[model samples]
Target: MPSLPKPRLRRPARGRGSAVAHAPEPETPNVEVVEHDGLRWVNIVQPRQVDRAWLEEHFAFHPLDYEDVFSRNQRPKVDEYEDYLFVVLHFPAFDKQVGRLNAAEVDVFVGPDFVITLPNQPIQPLEYLFTQAQQRDDVRASLFGKGAGYLLYKIVDDCVDASFPMLRKIGNKLERLEEDIFEGRSGEIVRDLSNAKQEIINFRKIVRPQRSALADLERTKRYIPDDLDIYFDDINDASERIWDMLENFKEVVEGLESTNESVLSHQLNDVLRVLTAFSAVMLPLTFVASIFGMNVHVPGQDSITAFWIVIAFMVGLLGGMFYLFRRRGWL
Candidate 1:
């Protein structure tokens, strides 16, 4: 294979007194090239903002793939062309205000000699991978030295690994919610659990289809190298693990919701029990007072001691009812 061309460097000044040579023009800021061992990787971030004419002029990619580029909300899939493979993968992107994960789309065009990447959202893992590839020759060699197939593997692997941190954050949030529920601080826990459950569902929506896409890539022909098949398998395994974790999270959130309902029901039942006991004790006293308040002449109506006698009789009746309730274990 022929060696790759070196970057154009400006000639240095001939002598100390000579004027400094003009610096070479910089490449487009949005476009980055990583080259090693005759392999080339071109990564374009946020291609929507870049001029469409530039993409049309540069690469002889399939018309359908280019059309897919302009299209929005494409499902996770891999389409094989004669000369390259077009892959659309969605990764989890968290929304802080909504407290949920959203799908972030990444389009990858993998050809025999080169790979092109365009991402719709700011993917931190991809950014870090590019930075490392730029700064470290070892990283560049390990990634760019291989064919486009292996480079795609690296990108998908990084994307899959990115979810682990977010999963940890959600796991911690769940633990805190469980603690709050048990401590009688469950007022806001219902809302928090609902958000968590929705987040888990969002993760599932992104991960399950992504896992299928990776599985398809593993079986894809022509563009994918034979030896690199195992690497894609590893990526598929990671995606499957993510899906399983999401399922577990959904179950936990459901359990939390059930526990919250039980706790609330028990609390309400206790309140109703206390109210019933108060009403039962007050019923007879109310009846006795009504009798005394009547206009009809009854026994001991003329004696001043009648009022005291009735009061003592009501107090004794209240004590007897309390004793009966205690004996029945209703209080």
Candidate 2:
């Protein structure tokens, strides 16, 4: 047979490539979109109280879910619907003004062909990850080539991984505080321990509820379209590990508080012991001076030799008392 006829060329679009099957979706004030390889990722940043109508207009999420999304400080949880799954996850984001970690809540909706992320606050890692998948061809291929389930797993996994660095920072701070506790810096260490303890408590509050939610993820499926049990398990394991670390930190901080209190108590006892010893030594000398200073017939009041003898006797009494204190181990 002769060579095949030259293929009739279908010209690519004028602006964008042919691989993009649809025109780009317009973004609203609080919403952004990234599409690649037939997968769509919608990211909503800090939606306002009235923005639930937008979500309801686009997605058939439950009213309660919308309430949870717009609400502040919702507990971390996972709610499985008939055609979608709603997940709430938390990560510690530091608040520089208050100088502590605050829980950033991200509500996710996973469906057959799309993944939606609605964060209650600006999460830098989530923002960065979404941007990477949106801008970089390789990142988009790697992340969107997989199904929605796998993409969801990666999103949660990246957030879970970001916590380790914060944990490391907390660990280093505790080590330094442990050293300062013994270096006569208990005054400062007391405040340090309080701040660290508060951070641990807040972080634990974030991780504890989220652990159960992540564990329930694999079972709560509808349109996820992939058997990502292993991937979800990995995220679950990471959440468990984070919770364990926070538990350990709680105990460590409590122990530090007790140790600091003990050090302070010991220092107080040392000061009080010195004051008591000095007061005991001065009692007899004070009585002797008072008696001689009175306008009464004291024994050594009339003679100069008597005054020298009295002075010598008082010096001997002082030496004797000092010797007694040294022998009693109370000096």
C-alpha positional error of residue 227 in candidate 1 after TM-score superposition, expressed in Å: 1.8
Candidate 2 worst ten-residue window by lDDT = 1-10
How well is each residue in 126-192 modelled by candidate 1, as lDDT tens digits?
9899889989998988887667777888888898899999998988988999999999977667888
- Write down the TM-score of every candidate: 0.88, 0.88
* Model 1 pairs whose backbones collide: none
The root-mean-square deviation over C-alpha atoms between each candidate and the true structure, in angstroms, is 6.1, 9.4
The true-versus-predicted C-alpha distance at residue 74 of model 1, in Å, is 0.9
TM-score of model number 1: 0.88
Query: Per the 3 Å backbone cut-off, how many clashing residue pairs does candidate 1 have?
Result: 0
